[model samples]
Target: MSALIYCPFPDREAARAAANTLLDRKLIACANLLGEVESIYSWNGERGDSFEIGALFKTSAALLDDAIQCLAEMHPYDTPAIMGWRCVSVSEATAAWLGELDRGG
Candidate 1:
């Protein structure tokens, strides 16, 4: 039941802040932040390109909703790109760690 959530922020600081908030709330087990990434997408019928900080959060399915809520509350962007999917496969250790978080360990 493990999942990986992807959140893109306006900057590295914002990403870090959101990640820290999620961690503090025990909504996610781990977060890996990519300091710089170029994102090209169409918003409001216009093509836009910008640099962003991408964060990957590891957690269990049970915490996915909480993780998304944390991101929405802490993200600086008016509409943050918060998306995720259930992991099809994961190492036993990683799954165990996520389970521990689920158990409040």
Candidate 2:
């Protein structure tokens, strides 16, 4: 199985750093960065709003746990938003690509 992970960073540099680290470690096959996203949420019984950089990572389910651990260690925030979900459907080519990535190809 393959998975897609989403994480929000305080800035683009941080997001890129995490993405590059994951990629270098072969924990993620690909990463897409979304810059300057306005995020609104509640924290500690308070409403908060800020701009952040969002990143989406693609990898095999077998690597998800390790990838998450790496992200947690590399993340700047005390509680970074690191989320992932199994991919229920994917093209044959994409699946094959992910498989190759898992094999370090």
Candidate 3:
């Protein structure tokens, strides 16, 4: 199985850096960095908002937990937003690649 992991970062540079790290480490095969995502939330019991970048990573399900752990360790925020869901359908080539990744190929 594979997943499309979603995570939000405070800046494009941060998102790109994270993406590169994941890709280089083979934790993720690809990362789509969507920048300029406007976000609204309450922080420290106060209403706040800002533009953020979203990172969508393509990776096997086996890497989800560890990848999120790494993100938590490296994240700058008090709590980082990292979520992932299994991919039920994908191209055969992509699926095979994900399997290979899980096998540490």
Candidate 4:
């Protein structure tokens, strides 16, 4: 199965940096930046809103955990919102590509 990781970065530069790191490490096959988005949430007993750059990472299920862990460690926010999950249904060709990507295929 394939996996998807959704994370919001502080800015475009940060998002690009993180995406490149993930690619260089072979943690993700590709990443898509969704531009700026307004995020509203409560943190540390306070509620606030801010604009963030959204990113989607494509990878295999085998690398999802490692990818998320690495991203969390490198993220700028004290508690960045990183969401990941295995895809319930993915085309055979795409799944194969994602798996092969992690193996440097």
Each model's TM-score, in the order given?
0.93, 0.94, 0.90, 0.93
Instruction: Output the lDDT of residue 73, model 1.
Output: 78
**Residue-by-residue lDDT tens digits, candidate 4, 19-98:** 99998889999999999999998888999999999999999998999999999999999898999999979998897899
lDDT of candidate 4 at residue 54, scale 0 to 100: 98
lDDT of each: 0.87, 0.90, 0.84, 0.93
> 3-67 in candidate 2: lDDT tens per residue?
99999999989988999999899998899996678899999999999999989999988888899
**Sort by lDDT, top down from the best:** 4, 2, 1, 3
lDDT of 2: 0.90
lDDT of 4 at 11: 100
Which stretches in model 2 have alpha-carbon errors above 4 Å?
none
Q: What TM-score does candidate 1 reach?
A: 0.93
Tens-digit lDDT track for model 1 on 1-105? 899899888887787888788888899989999678899999999999999888899999888888888788778888888998899788898889998879986
Positional deviation of residue 103's Cα in model 1 after best superposition, in angstroms = 0.6
Candidate 1 global lDDT: 0.87
| Candidate 3 lDDT over residue span 30-93, tens digit each | 8898767888999889998888988888888898877777777877787988998888898889
The collision pairs in model 1 are none
